[model samples]
Target: MVAENSTPHLHSAVEPRQTFRRALDMAARAAMPSLFVMFCAILLSAPFGIPGQAQLQFGIAMCTVWFWAYSRPRSMPALAVFLCGLVVEIFSFGPPGTVLLSLLVIYGVAHHWRYGLSRLGFIAGWLIFSIFAVLASFFQWALVCLHAVALLSPAPGLFQAALTIGIYPSLTALFVWGRRTFANPDQA
Candidate 1:
Protein backbone atom coordinates (compact mmCIF):
# COMPACT_ATOMS: atom_id res chain seq x y z
CA MET A 1 0.00 0.00 0.00
CA VAL A 2 1.07 3.59 -0.65
CA ALA A 3 2.16 5.46 2.41
CA GLU A 4 0.23 8.67 3.05
CA ASN A 5 3.41 10.44 4.02
CA SER A 6 4.87 9.94 0.54
CA THR A 7 2.30 12.14 -1.14
CA PRO A 8 2.55 15.30 0.92
CA HIS A 9 4.45 17.10 -1.84
CA LEU A 10 1.38 16.86 -4.08
CA HIS A 11 -0.68 18.97 -1.71
CA SER A 12 1.69 21.91 -1.46
CA ALA A 13 0.57 24.85 -3.63
CA VAL A 14 3.83 26.68 -2.96
CA GLU A 15 5.71 24.23 -5.19
CA PRO A 16 3.50 24.38 -8.20
CA ARG A 17 6.34 24.04 -10.72
CA GLN A 18 7.73 21.05 -8.92
CA THR A 19 4.25 19.55 -8.71
CA PHE A 20 3.82 19.96 -12.44
CA ARG A 21 7.16 18.42 -13.15
CA ARG A 22 6.38 15.48 -10.90
CA ALA A 23 3.01 15.02 -12.52
CA LEU A 24 4.59 15.04 -15.95
CA ASP A 25 7.05 12.44 -14.80
CA MET A 26 4.22 10.31 -13.52
CA ALA A 27 2.34 10.56 -16.81
CA ALA A 28 5.40 9.56 -18.83
CA ARG A 29 5.95 6.56 -16.60
CA ALA A 30 2.34 5.49 -16.98
CA ALA A 31 2.38 5.91 -20.76
CA MET A 32 5.41 3.78 -21.49
CA PRO A 33 3.61 0.48 -21.98
CA SER A 34 0.86 1.84 -24.19
CA LEU A 35 3.40 3.83 -26.15
CA PHE A 36 5.54 0.76 -26.70
CA VAL A 37 2.51 -1.09 -28.00
CA MET A 38 1.75 1.75 -30.37
CA PHE A 39 5.30 1.71 -31.63
CA CYS A 40 5.07 -2.01 -32.24
CA ALA A 41 1.90 -1.59 -34.25
CA ILE A 42 3.58 0.94 -36.47
CA LEU A 43 6.69 -1.12 -36.96
CA LEU A 44 4.92 -4.42 -37.56
CA SER A 45 2.38 -3.10 -40.01
CA ALA A 46 5.05 -2.40 -42.56
CA PRO A 47 5.45 -4.80 -45.51
CA PHE A 48 8.04 -7.33 -44.39
CA GLY A 49 7.68 -9.99 -47.11
CA ILE A 50 5.64 -12.18 -44.79
CA PRO A 51 2.18 -13.47 -45.58
CA GLY A 52 -0.57 -12.18 -43.31
CA GLN A 53 1.78 -9.54 -41.85
CA ALA A 54 -1.01 -7.01 -41.70
CA GLN A 55 -3.25 -9.49 -39.98
CA LEU A 56 -0.59 -10.16 -37.34
CA GLN A 57 -0.12 -6.49 -36.69
CA PHE A 58 -3.86 -5.97 -36.49
CA GLY A 59 -4.15 -8.74 -33.94
CA ILE A 60 -1.38 -7.20 -31.89
CA ALA A 61 -3.05 -3.80 -31.96
CA MET A 62 -6.39 -5.17 -30.84
CA CYS A 63 -4.86 -7.35 -28.14
CA THR A 64 -2.75 -4.52 -26.80
CA VAL A 65 -5.75 -2.22 -26.53
CA TRP A 66 -7.78 -4.82 -24.68
CA PHE A 67 -4.97 -5.96 -22.37
CA TRP A 68 -3.98 -2.47 -21.29
CA ALA A 69 -7.53 -1.32 -20.80
CA TYR A 70 -8.42 -4.41 -18.83
CA SER A 71 -5.28 -4.53 -16.70
CA ARG A 72 -4.20 -0.91 -16.31
CA PRO A 73 -6.99 1.51 -17.10
CA ARG A 74 -5.30 4.50 -15.52
CA SER A 75 -2.18 4.13 -17.64
CA MET A 76 -4.09 3.43 -20.82
CA PRO A 77 -5.94 6.76 -20.70
CA ALA A 78 -8.46 7.72 -23.35
CA LEU A 79 -6.19 10.37 -24.85
CA ALA A 80 -3.40 7.88 -25.38
CA VAL A 81 -5.79 5.36 -26.87
CA PHE A 82 -7.23 7.99 -29.20
CA LEU A 83 -3.82 9.08 -30.40
CA CYS A 84 -2.71 5.50 -30.79
CA GLY A 85 -5.82 4.77 -32.78
CA LEU A 86 -4.97 7.56 -35.17
CA VAL A 87 -1.49 6.19 -35.72
CA VAL A 88 -2.92 2.70 -36.08
CA GLU A 89 -5.42 3.92 -38.65
CA ILE A 90 -2.66 5.44 -40.71
CA PHE A 91 -0.58 2.31 -40.47
CA SER A 92 -3.45 -0.03 -41.25
CA PHE A 93 -4.83 2.26 -43.98
CA GLY A 94 -8.33 1.97 -42.65
CA PRO A 95 -11.24 4.34 -43.15
CA PRO A 96 -10.85 7.57 -41.22
CA GLY A 97 -12.20 7.58 -37.65
CA THR A 98 -12.85 3.85 -37.74
CA VAL A 99 -9.84 2.80 -35.67
CA LEU A 100 -10.21 5.68 -33.28
CA LEU A 101 -13.86 4.93 -32.69
CA SER A 102 -13.23 1.24 -32.23
CA LEU A 103 -10.39 1.78 -29.77
CA LEU A 104 -12.44 4.24 -27.76
CA VAL A 105 -15.37 1.85 -27.56
CA ILE A 106 -13.19 -1.05 -26.42
CA TYR A 107 -11.37 1.08 -23.90
CA GLY A 108 -14.60 2.49 -22.54
CA VAL A 109 -16.15 -0.92 -22.08
CA ALA A 110 -13.08 -2.43 -20.46
CA HIS A 111 -12.55 0.54 -18.14
CA HIS A 112 -16.17 0.39 -17.03
CA TRP A 113 -16.03 -3.34 -16.39
CA ARG A 114 -12.59 -3.43 -14.80
CA TYR A 115 -13.90 -4.18 -11.36
CA GLY A 116 -16.26 -6.86 -12.58
CA LEU A 117 -13.47 -8.64 -14.48
CA SER A 118 -10.89 -8.17 -11.76
CA ARG A 119 -11.86 -11.38 -9.98
CA LEU A 120 -12.32 -13.48 -13.09
CA GLY A 121 -9.69 -15.76 -14.59
CA PHE A 122 -8.01 -15.75 -17.98
CA ILE A 123 -10.93 -17.51 -19.67
CA ALA A 124 -13.32 -14.73 -18.72
CA GLY A 125 -10.95 -12.09 -20.01
CA TRP A 126 -10.62 -13.99 -23.26
CA LEU A 127 -14.40 -14.24 -23.60
CA ILE A 128 -14.84 -10.53 -23.01
CA PHE A 129 -12.16 -9.77 -25.59
CA SER A 130 -13.85 -12.10 -28.08
CA ILE A 131 -17.08 -10.15 -27.77
CA PHE A 132 -15.28 -6.86 -28.28
CA ALA A 133 -13.46 -8.26 -31.30
CA VAL A 134 -16.74 -9.13 -33.00
CA LEU A 135 -18.25 -5.74 -32.26
CA ALA A 136 -15.13 -3.87 -33.39
CA SER A 137 -14.97 -5.89 -36.62
CA PHE A 138 -18.63 -5.16 -37.34
CA PHE A 139 -18.06 -1.47 -36.70
CA GLN A 140 -15.13 -1.43 -39.10
CA TRP A 141 -17.01 -3.43 -41.70
CA ALA A 142 -19.89 -0.98 -41.54
CA LEU A 143 -17.49 1.91 -41.94
CA VAL A 144 -15.88 0.29 -44.97
CA CYS A 145 -19.24 -0.41 -46.53
CA LEU A 146 -20.27 3.20 -46.07
CA HIS A 147 -16.96 4.52 -47.37
CA ALA A 148 -17.08 2.35 -50.48
CA VAL A 149 -20.77 3.21 -51.04
CA ALA A 150 -21.66 -0.48 -51.28
CA LEU A 151 -22.59 -3.33 -49.01
CA LEU A 152 -19.28 -5.07 -48.61
CA SER A 153 -18.84 -8.69 -47.69
CA PRO A 154 -17.95 -9.36 -44.05
CA ALA A 155 -15.37 -12.06 -44.75
CA PRO A 156 -12.27 -9.92 -44.18
CA GLY A 157 -13.51 -8.60 -40.86
CA LEU A 158 -14.53 -12.06 -39.72
CA PHE A 159 -11.10 -13.42 -40.64
CA GLN A 160 -9.40 -10.60 -38.72
CA ALA A 161 -11.52 -11.22 -35.62
CA ALA A 162 -10.69 -14.90 -35.78
CA LEU A 163 -7.00 -14.14 -36.10
CA THR A 164 -7.15 -11.73 -33.17
CA ILE A 165 -8.82 -14.29 -30.96
CA GLY A 166 -6.29 -16.90 -31.96
CA ILE A 167 -3.30 -14.79 -30.95
CA TYR A 168 -4.67 -13.08 -27.85
CA PRO A 169 -3.32 -15.53 -25.28
CA SER A 170 0.27 -15.10 -26.36
CA LEU A 171 -0.06 -11.35 -26.50
CA THR A 172 -1.67 -11.24 -23.07
CA ALA A 173 1.22 -13.15 -21.55
CA LEU A 174 3.73 -10.81 -23.21
CA PHE A 175 1.90 -7.73 -21.95
CA VAL A 176 1.76 -9.19 -18.47
CA TRP A 177 5.52 -9.45 -18.57
CA GLY A 178 5.85 -5.94 -19.98
CA ARG A 179 3.66 -4.57 -17.20
CA ARG A 180 5.79 -6.16 -14.55
CA THR A 181 8.99 -4.98 -16.18
CA PHE A 182 7.98 -1.39 -16.88
CA ALA A 183 5.59 -0.81 -14.01
CA ASN A 184 6.24 1.69 -11.25
CA PRO A 185 8.13 0.30 -8.31
CA ASP A 186 5.12 0.59 -6.05
CA GLN A 187 2.94 -1.27 -8.48
CA ALA A 188 5.60 -3.87 -9.07
Candidate 2:
Protein backbone atom coordinates (compact mmCIF):
# COMPACT_ATOMS: atom_id res chain seq x y z
CA MET A 1 0.00 0.00 0.00
CA VAL A 2 3.05 2.30 0.25
CA ALA A 3 4.24 4.41 -2.67
CA GLU A 4 7.17 2.82 -4.55
CA ASN A 5 9.14 6.11 -4.85
CA SER A 6 8.82 7.02 -1.20
CA THR A 7 12.03 8.39 0.38
CA PRO A 8 11.36 7.06 3.89
CA HIS A 9 14.34 4.70 3.61
CA LEU A 10 16.58 7.61 2.58
CA HIS A 11 15.44 9.62 5.61
CA SER A 12 15.98 6.62 7.87
CA ALA A 13 19.55 6.15 6.66
CA VAL A 14 20.23 9.87 7.23
CA GLU A 15 18.66 9.97 10.69
CA PRO A 16 21.76 9.16 12.72
CA ARG A 17 23.87 11.83 11.08
CA GLN A 18 21.06 14.31 11.46
CA THR A 19 20.76 13.42 15.11
CA PHE A 20 24.48 13.96 15.65
CA ARG A 21 24.34 17.27 13.89
CA ARG A 22 21.44 18.33 16.08
CA ALA A 23 23.35 17.41 19.21
CA LEU A 24 26.30 19.47 18.11
CA ASP A 25 24.03 22.37 17.21
CA MET A 26 22.39 22.32 20.61
CA ALA A 27 25.80 22.26 22.28
CA ALA A 28 27.01 25.26 20.31
CA ARG A 29 23.85 27.15 21.17
CA ALA A 30 24.41 26.47 24.85
CA ALA A 31 28.01 27.58 24.52
CA MET A 32 27.28 30.96 22.98
CA PRO A 33 26.22 32.65 26.25
CA SER A 34 29.08 31.06 28.17
CA LEU A 35 31.46 32.19 25.48
CA PHE A 36 30.38 35.79 25.97
CA VAL A 37 30.85 35.58 29.72
CA MET A 38 34.27 33.96 29.27
CA PHE A 39 35.35 36.70 26.95
CA CYS A 40 34.35 39.28 29.54
CA ALA A 41 36.30 37.41 32.19
CA ILE A 42 39.36 37.53 29.95
CA LEU A 43 38.87 41.25 29.65
CA LEU A 44 38.60 41.54 33.39
CA SER A 45 41.90 39.74 33.81
CA ALA A 46 43.73 41.50 31.05
CA PRO A 47 46.40 43.92 32.19
CA PHE A 48 44.86 46.88 30.47
CA GLY A 49 44.90 48.39 33.96
CA ILE A 50 42.68 51.17 32.82
CA PRO A 51 40.89 53.18 35.47
CA GLY A 52 37.37 51.92 36.16
CA GLN A 53 38.07 48.80 34.10
CA ALA A 54 36.73 46.57 36.81
CA GLN A 55 33.49 48.45 36.74
CA LEU A 56 33.33 48.15 32.99
CA GLN A 57 34.26 44.49 33.13
CA PHE A 58 31.58 43.56 35.61
CA GLY A 59 29.01 45.69 33.84
CA ILE A 60 29.64 43.98 30.53
CA ALA A 61 29.68 40.58 32.18
CA MET A 62 26.38 41.10 33.93
CA CYS A 63 24.84 42.61 30.83
CA THR A 64 25.93 39.64 28.78
CA VAL A 65 24.09 37.33 31.12
CA TRP A 66 21.03 39.54 31.29
CA PHE A 67 20.98 39.97 27.53
CA TRP A 68 20.87 36.27 26.84
CA ALA A 69 18.48 35.59 29.65
CA TYR A 70 16.05 38.15 28.38
CA SER A 71 16.39 37.29 24.71
CA ARG A 72 16.92 33.53 24.85
CA PRO A 73 16.34 32.15 28.30
CA ARG A 74 17.16 28.63 27.14
CA SER A 75 20.63 29.70 26.07
CA MET A 76 21.52 31.17 29.46
CA PRO A 77 20.95 28.38 31.91
CA ALA A 78 21.48 28.60 35.65
CA LEU A 79 24.55 26.34 35.41
CA ALA A 80 26.16 28.64 32.85
CA VAL A 81 25.36 31.61 35.11
CA PHE A 82 27.06 29.83 37.99
CA LEU A 83 30.11 29.11 35.89
CA CYS A 84 30.23 32.74 34.89
CA GLY A 85 30.23 33.65 38.55
CA LEU A 86 33.14 31.31 39.17
CA VAL A 87 34.95 32.90 36.29
CA VAL A 88 34.38 36.34 37.77
CA GLU A 89 35.65 35.24 41.16
CA ILE A 90 38.81 33.84 39.61
CA PHE A 91 39.48 36.82 37.36
CA SER A 92 38.41 39.83 39.38
CA PHE A 93 40.14 39.11 42.68
CA GLY A 94 37.00 39.97 44.57
CA PRO A 95 35.48 38.12 47.49
CA PRO A 96 33.82 34.99 46.15
CA GLY A 97 30.12 35.26 45.21
CA THR A 98 30.02 39.05 44.86
CA VAL A 99 29.74 39.25 41.09
CA LEU A 100 27.89 35.98 40.93
CA LEU A 101 25.17 37.15 43.24
CA SER A 102 24.67 40.39 41.37
CA LEU A 103 24.47 38.59 38.03
CA LEU A 104 21.98 36.11 39.39
CA VAL A 105 19.76 38.96 40.47
CA ILE A 106 19.92 40.50 37.03
CA TYR A 107 19.23 37.17 35.37
CA GLY A 108 16.24 36.63 37.58
CA VAL A 109 14.73 40.00 36.82
CA ALA A 110 15.34 39.70 33.08
CA HIS A 111 14.02 36.17 32.91
CA HIS A 112 10.93 37.08 34.83
CA TRP A 113 10.03 39.76 32.36
CA ARG A 114 11.35 38.08 29.25
CA TYR A 115 7.98 37.29 27.80
CA GLY A 116 6.55 40.78 28.26
CA LEU A 117 9.77 42.61 27.48
CA SER A 118 10.29 40.84 24.18
CA ARG A 119 7.05 42.37 22.96
CA LEU A 120 7.49 45.78 24.62
CA GLY A 121 10.47 46.99 22.56
CA PHE A 122 13.73 48.77 23.49
CA ILE A 123 12.79 51.84 25.49
CA ALA A 124 10.71 49.88 27.94
CA GLY A 125 13.35 47.22 28.25
CA TRP A 126 16.05 49.81 28.84
CA LEU A 127 13.93 51.57 31.44
CA ILE A 128 13.30 48.36 33.33
CA PHE A 129 16.99 47.51 33.16
CA SER A 130 17.82 50.92 34.58
CA ILE A 131 15.80 50.32 37.73
CA PHE A 132 17.01 46.74 38.14
CA ALA A 133 20.62 47.75 37.60
CA VAL A 134 20.45 50.29 40.39
CA LEU A 135 18.95 47.82 42.85
CA ALA A 136 21.33 45.02 41.91
CA SER A 137 24.36 47.29 42.01
CA PHE A 138 23.36 48.53 45.43
CA PHE A 139 23.07 44.97 46.69
CA GLN A 140 26.52 44.13 45.34
CA TRP A 141 27.95 47.22 47.00
CA ALA A 142 26.48 46.25 50.33
CA LEU A 143 27.84 42.71 50.09
CA VAL A 144 31.33 43.92 49.27
CA CYS A 145 31.18 46.34 52.16
CA LEU A 146 30.01 43.65 54.53
CA HIS A 147 32.70 41.24 53.37
CA ALA A 148 35.43 43.84 53.82
CA VAL A 149 34.06 45.00 57.17
CA ALA A 150 34.18 48.59 55.90
CA LEU A 151 31.76 50.62 53.87
CA LEU A 152 33.13 50.62 50.37
CA SER A 153 32.68 53.50 48.00
CA PRO A 154 29.74 52.78 45.70
CA ALA A 155 30.85 55.02 42.83
CA PRO A 156 32.31 52.19 40.81
CA GLY A 157 29.19 50.09 41.10
CA LEU A 158 27.04 53.04 40.13
CA PHE A 159 29.25 53.66 37.15
CA GLN A 160 28.92 50.05 36.12
CA ALA A 161 25.15 50.18 36.08
CA ALA A 162 25.17 53.42 34.14
CA LEU A 163 27.60 52.06 31.61
CA THR A 164 25.64 48.89 31.14
CA ILE A 165 22.40 50.72 30.59
CA GLY A 166 24.12 53.04 28.15
CA ILE A 167 25.76 50.35 26.07
CA TYR A 168 22.98 47.78 26.03
CA PRO A 169 21.61 48.65 22.61
CA SER A 170 24.94 48.25 20.86
CA LEU A 171 25.78 45.13 22.79
CA THR A 172 22.37 43.69 22.13
CA ALA A 173 23.02 44.08 18.43
CA LEU A 174 26.33 42.29 18.76
CA PHE A 175 24.72 39.50 20.72
CA VAL A 176 22.04 39.21 18.07
CA TRP A 177 24.69 38.91 15.40
CA GLY A 178 26.42 36.25 17.45
CA ARG A 179 23.23 34.25 17.81
CA ARG A 180 22.46 34.52 14.15
CA THR A 181 25.93 33.44 13.16
CA PHE A 182 26.34 30.65 15.67
CA ALA A 183 22.86 29.43 16.63
CA ASN A 184 21.42 26.33 15.00
CA PRO A 185 19.04 26.73 12.08
CA ASP A 186 16.18 25.28 14.03
CA GLN A 187 16.53 27.93 16.73
CA ALA A 188 17.04 30.66 14.16
Candidate 3:
Protein backbone atom coordinates (compact mmCIF):
# COMPACT_ATOMS: atom_id res chain seq x y z
CA MET A 1 0.00 0.00 0.00
CA VAL A 2 2.88 2.43 0.72
CA ALA A 3 4.48 1.56 -2.61
CA GLU A 4 1.14 2.22 -4.41
CA ASN A 5 0.90 5.66 -2.78
CA SER A 6 4.53 6.38 -3.66
CA THR A 7 3.87 5.36 -7.25
CA PRO A 8 1.18 8.05 -7.55
CA HIS A 9 3.68 10.70 -6.33
CA LEU A 10 6.24 9.47 -8.85
CA HIS A 11 3.70 9.64 -11.65
CA SER A 12 2.73 13.17 -10.69
CA ALA A 13 6.40 14.15 -10.78
CA VAL A 14 6.82 12.61 -14.23
CA GLU A 15 3.68 14.34 -15.53
CA PRO A 16 5.12 17.82 -15.02
CA ARG A 17 8.23 16.84 -16.93
CA GLN A 18 6.11 15.71 -19.84
CA THR A 19 4.14 18.93 -19.77
CA PHE A 20 7.36 20.95 -19.67
CA ARG A 21 8.79 18.99 -22.56
CA ARG A 22 5.68 19.58 -24.65
CA ALA A 23 5.81 23.29 -23.90
CA LEU A 24 9.44 23.42 -24.93
CA ASP A 25 8.62 21.63 -28.14
CA MET A 26 5.81 24.02 -28.91
CA ALA A 27 8.07 27.00 -28.24
CA ALA A 28 10.79 25.61 -30.45
CA ARG A 29 8.27 25.07 -33.24
CA ALA A 30 7.09 28.65 -32.86
CA ALA A 31 10.50 30.31 -32.82
CA MET A 32 11.60 30.35 -36.46
CA PRO A 33 8.27 31.55 -37.79
CA SER A 34 8.08 34.31 -35.22
CA LEU A 35 11.57 35.44 -36.15
CA PHE A 36 10.63 35.48 -39.82
CA VAL A 37 7.61 37.66 -39.22
CA MET A 38 9.69 40.09 -37.19
CA PHE A 39 12.19 40.25 -40.00
CA CYS A 40 9.49 41.08 -42.49
CA ALA A 41 8.07 43.83 -40.31
CA ILE A 42 11.44 45.50 -39.91
CA LEU A 43 12.31 45.04 -43.55
CA LEU A 44 9.09 46.58 -44.76
CA SER A 45 9.16 49.41 -42.27
CA ALA A 46 12.83 50.35 -42.75
CA PRO A 47 12.74 51.81 -46.26
CA PHE A 48 9.56 53.87 -45.96
CA GLY A 49 9.91 57.66 -46.10
CA ILE A 50 9.50 59.02 -42.61
CA PRO A 51 8.66 62.67 -42.14
CA GLY A 52 6.41 63.28 -45.09
CA GLN A 53 4.12 60.41 -44.26
CA ALA A 54 5.02 59.77 -40.68
CA GLN A 55 1.48 59.85 -39.39
CA LEU A 56 0.22 57.51 -42.05
CA GLN A 57 3.19 55.22 -41.60
CA PHE A 58 2.67 55.16 -37.90
CA GLY A 59 -0.96 54.32 -38.48
CA ILE A 60 0.03 51.43 -40.69
CA ALA A 61 2.46 50.12 -38.11
CA MET A 62 -0.11 50.48 -35.39
CA CYS A 63 -2.61 48.52 -37.43
CA THR A 64 -0.04 45.83 -38.17
CA VAL A 65 1.06 45.45 -34.59
CA TRP A 66 -2.47 45.50 -33.33
CA PHE A 67 -3.32 42.68 -35.66
CA TRP A 68 -0.35 40.74 -34.36
CA ALA A 69 -1.39 41.46 -30.80
CA TYR A 70 -4.71 39.83 -31.52
CA SER A 71 -3.05 36.86 -33.17
CA ARG A 72 -0.53 36.03 -30.46
CA PRO A 73 -1.07 38.17 -27.42
CA ARG A 74 1.23 36.00 -25.38
CA SER A 75 4.05 36.00 -27.89
CA MET A 76 4.28 39.74 -28.62
CA PRO A 77 5.01 41.27 -25.27
CA ALA A 78 3.88 44.82 -24.44
CA LEU A 79 7.40 46.19 -24.00
CA ALA A 80 8.42 44.95 -27.43
CA VAL A 81 5.39 46.62 -28.95
CA PHE A 82 6.16 49.83 -27.12
CA LEU A 83 9.79 49.69 -28.19
CA CYS A 84 8.75 49.14 -31.78
CA GLY A 85 6.50 52.15 -31.56
CA LEU A 86 9.35 54.13 -29.99
CA VAL A 87 11.69 53.25 -32.81
CA VAL A 88 9.12 54.26 -35.39
CA GLU A 89 8.47 57.53 -33.59
CA ILE A 90 12.17 58.39 -33.30
CA PHE A 91 12.92 57.60 -36.90
CA SER A 92 9.84 59.34 -38.16
CA PHE A 93 9.01 62.96 -37.42
CA GLY A 94 6.51 63.16 -34.60
CA PRO A 95 6.01 64.41 -31.10
CA PRO A 96 7.24 61.73 -28.69
CA GLY A 97 3.86 60.92 -27.21
CA THR A 98 2.09 60.50 -30.49
CA VAL A 99 3.13 56.97 -31.35
CA LEU A 100 3.57 55.86 -27.77
CA LEU A 101 0.11 56.99 -26.75
CA SER A 102 -1.47 55.59 -29.88
CA LEU A 103 0.30 52.25 -29.56
CA LEU A 104 -0.53 52.03 -25.88
CA VAL A 105 -4.17 52.69 -26.55
CA ILE A 106 -4.26 50.16 -29.38
CA TYR A 107 -2.47 47.61 -27.22
CA GLY A 108 -5.06 48.03 -24.52
CA VAL A 109 -7.90 47.64 -26.97
CA ALA A 110 -6.32 44.60 -28.60
CA HIS A 111 -5.53 42.93 -25.30
CA HIS A 112 -9.09 43.55 -24.23
CA TRP A 113 -10.25 41.58 -27.25
CA ARG A 114 -7.51 38.97 -27.05
CA TYR A 115 -9.87 36.03 -26.79
CA GLY A 116 -11.98 36.87 -29.82
CA LEU A 117 -9.49 37.22 -32.65
CA SER A 118 -11.14 35.94 -35.81
CA ARG A 119 -11.32 36.52 -39.57
CA LEU A 120 -13.15 39.76 -38.91
CA GLY A 121 -11.03 40.50 -35.90
CA PHE A 122 -9.05 42.97 -37.94
CA ILE A 123 -12.19 44.91 -38.75
CA ALA A 124 -13.25 44.95 -35.12
CA GLY A 125 -9.80 46.05 -34.06
CA TRP A 126 -9.77 48.83 -36.66
CA LEU A 127 -12.98 50.22 -35.27
CA ILE A 128 -11.48 50.44 -31.81
CA PHE A 129 -8.26 51.89 -33.21
CA SER A 130 -10.17 54.45 -35.21
CA ILE A 131 -11.78 55.72 -32.06
CA PHE A 132 -8.43 56.16 -30.35
CA ALA A 133 -6.88 57.79 -33.42
CA VAL A 134 -9.73 60.26 -33.65
CA LEU A 135 -9.29 61.22 -30.02
CA ALA A 136 -5.54 61.53 -30.34
CA SER A 137 -5.82 63.66 -33.45
CA PHE A 138 -8.43 65.85 -31.86
CA PHE A 139 -6.25 66.41 -28.82
CA GLN A 140 -3.21 67.14 -30.94
CA TRP A 141 -5.16 69.54 -33.11
CA ALA A 142 -6.47 71.26 -30.04
CA LEU A 143 -2.90 71.69 -28.85
CA VAL A 144 -1.92 73.13 -32.21
CA CYS A 145 -4.91 75.45 -32.10
CA LEU A 146 -3.79 76.63 -28.69
CA HIS A 147 -0.27 77.21 -30.03
CA ALA A 148 1.19 74.35 -28.07
CA VAL A 149 3.14 73.91 -31.26
CA ALA A 150 1.71 76.31 -33.78
CA LEU A 151 -1.74 77.65 -34.55
CA LEU A 152 -3.35 75.32 -37.11
CA SER A 153 -6.66 74.48 -38.65
CA PRO A 154 -8.24 71.16 -37.79
CA ALA A 155 -9.40 70.41 -41.35
CA PRO A 156 -6.29 68.70 -42.59
CA GLY A 157 -6.02 66.71 -39.43
CA LEU A 158 -9.60 65.60 -39.83
CA PHE A 159 -8.85 64.50 -43.35
CA GLN A 160 -5.92 62.43 -42.13
CA ALA A 161 -8.06 60.95 -39.41
CA ALA A 162 -10.59 59.85 -41.98
CA LEU A 163 -7.82 58.39 -44.07
CA THR A 164 -6.48 56.46 -41.14
CA ILE A 165 -9.86 54.95 -40.53
CA GLY A 166 -10.25 54.13 -44.18
CA ILE A 167 -6.93 52.35 -44.47
CA TYR A 168 -6.67 50.55 -41.17
CA PRO A 169 -9.10 47.70 -41.67
CA SER A 170 -7.51 46.53 -44.89
CA LEU A 171 -3.98 46.96 -43.68
CA THR A 172 -4.84 45.08 -40.55
CA ALA A 173 -6.24 42.24 -42.60
CA LEU A 174 -3.02 41.99 -44.56
CA PHE A 175 -0.88 41.94 -41.45
CA VAL A 176 -3.14 39.51 -39.69
CA TRP A 177 -3.07 37.14 -42.65
CA GLY A 178 0.71 37.32 -42.79
CA ARG A 179 0.92 36.45 -39.14
CA ARG A 180 -1.56 33.59 -39.32
CA THR A 181 -0.19 31.87 -42.38
CA PHE A 182 3.47 32.24 -41.48
CA ALA A 183 3.79 32.62 -37.76
CA ASN A 184 3.27 28.99 -36.76
CA PRO A 185 1.21 25.92 -37.48
CA ASP A 186 -0.75 26.08 -34.27
CA GLN A 187 -1.29 29.81 -34.62
CA ALA A 188 -2.23 29.31 -38.24
If scored against the real structure, what TM-score would every candidate get?
Answer: 0.79, 0.81, 0.63
When 2 and 3 are scored with lDDT, the better candidate is 2
Stretches of model 2 off by over 4 angstroms after superposition: 1-22, 184-188
* 5-114: candidate 2 lDDT, tens digit per residue: 66467556645455777777778776877877787787768888787677766777777888888888888888888888788778886656778888888888888888
**Over the stretch 1-188, how does candidate 3's per-residue lDDT look in tens digits?**
78766655544654444466667655654453334334444554565654425456555666656666776775556776776666666565545566667777777777777776455544565676788778767865775566565677788668667766777767656655655654453532
- Least well predicted 10-residue stretch by lDDT in candidate 1: 179-188
Candidate 3 residue pairs in backbone clash = none
Task: Candidate 3: list runs displaced more than 4 Å.
Answer: 1-52, 116-125, 143-150, 185-188
Sort by TM-score, top down from the best: 2, 1, 3
Clashing pairs in 1: none
Model 2 residue 134 lDDT score: 82
lDDT against true structure, model 2: 0.78
User: Model 1 lDDT vs. the true structure?
Assistant: 0.78
Report how far off residue 103 is in candidate 3 (Å). 0.4
* lDDT of each candidate versus the true structure: 0.78, 0.78, 0.62
Going through the candidates in the order shown, the clash numbers are: 0, 0, 0
